[model samples]
Target: MKTVAVIDYGMGNLHSASKALEHVADRNTRVVVTCDPETILQADRVVLPGVGAIRDCMAEIRRRGVDDVVRQVVASERPLLGICVGMQVMLNHSEENGGVECLGLMSGNVKFFGRNLKDAAGNKLKVPHMGWSMVDQHQPHALWQGIEKNARFYFVHSYHAHAVDDEVAVGRCDYGVNFDVALAKGTVFAVQFHPEKSAANGLRLLENFLQWSP
Candidate 1:
């Protein structure tokens, strides 16, 4: 049976993510939410999902040896997905929690969306940037197979990643400023939005990840 390891480092939206993956996954596949390095390394795919600060996330990740496993997954060229803060932590550093160093899997920095934010209409935007927004799919990826271009995805983050290379950003969303909401590099693909909470499009993304080979 195919196994998808949703690494639980105590900071991710574990229940929701695992449930969603199981819901979309084939009956032959097994979805496991665990912190065990052996289970993670043995899985066909790995998902790193988070909903909190980068500092605490990194602390738990290293404390449980999940950091090394994540790097190994990347090095092994297996399909790996990062969600929300999970995606943020993939960068070189983050300004959150008074700044924290990240995994450096990708060349980028996470930055706050600024205290006073606004849309193009000049309306003030909230800090968390919560709610649904339209995402621009820049590149044609296998994950974007069924999902329509400019589809809306759920987002609830104050900090966004700034990739050093332009090609790293496969999807983007605009609030007050245009920032990368979805990034892909090598075997890794991470999103700033919560796919589990995103309804149909989100389910489709997770479904694609299950069948994704790289």
Candidate 2:
């Protein structure tokens, strides 16, 4: 049976993410939410989901020793999905918490959407960039299999990822500015938006991930 491990480092809405994964997973697949490094490394796939601040998230990730597990999973070439702060932590550094160092798995930086932001209509844009936004698929990838083009995904983040190389970005979204909402390299796929909260499209993305080989 296929096993998918949802890394639990004391951050993320683990219940929601695990439930969503369970809901979409096949009868033979097992979805486990755990902090155990052995379980994570042995799983068929790994998911790192986070919801809170980068500093706290990174601290817990390191404290729980999940950071090494994540690196190992990435190195194993097994599919790894990172959500929200989980994705941000993969960058070189985050502008949040006065700039915190990250895993540096990807060559990029996390930047906060400045307060002086505005929409095309000149209306003040919110800091967190909450609510749903259309995701513009930049390039074709396995994760985008069943998801339609320009599908709206749920987002609730202030800081967004900026890839050093544009080729890493597989999806883009606009919130007063165009920023990368999804990144893909080899077997790693991460998104700033919350797929579990994104309704149909979000669930479809997760389902696709479950079946994605590379």
Using all chains and alpha carbons, the TM-scores for the candidates as numbered come to 0.98, 0.98
What lDDT would each prediction earn against the true structure? 0.92, 0.92
lDDT of 2 at 105: 90
RMSD values, in order shown: 0.8, 0.8
Give lDDT tens digits, candidate 1, residues 35-56: 8888999999999999888899
lDDT of 2 by residue, 95-187 (tens): 899989999899999998998999999999989899999999998998898888999999999888898988899999998888998998889
Residue 151 Cα positional deviation in candidate 1, in Å, after optimal superposition: 0.6
Instruction: Report the error of model 2 at residue 72, Å.
Output: 0.5
RMSD to native, candidate 1: 0.8
lDDT of 1: 0.92
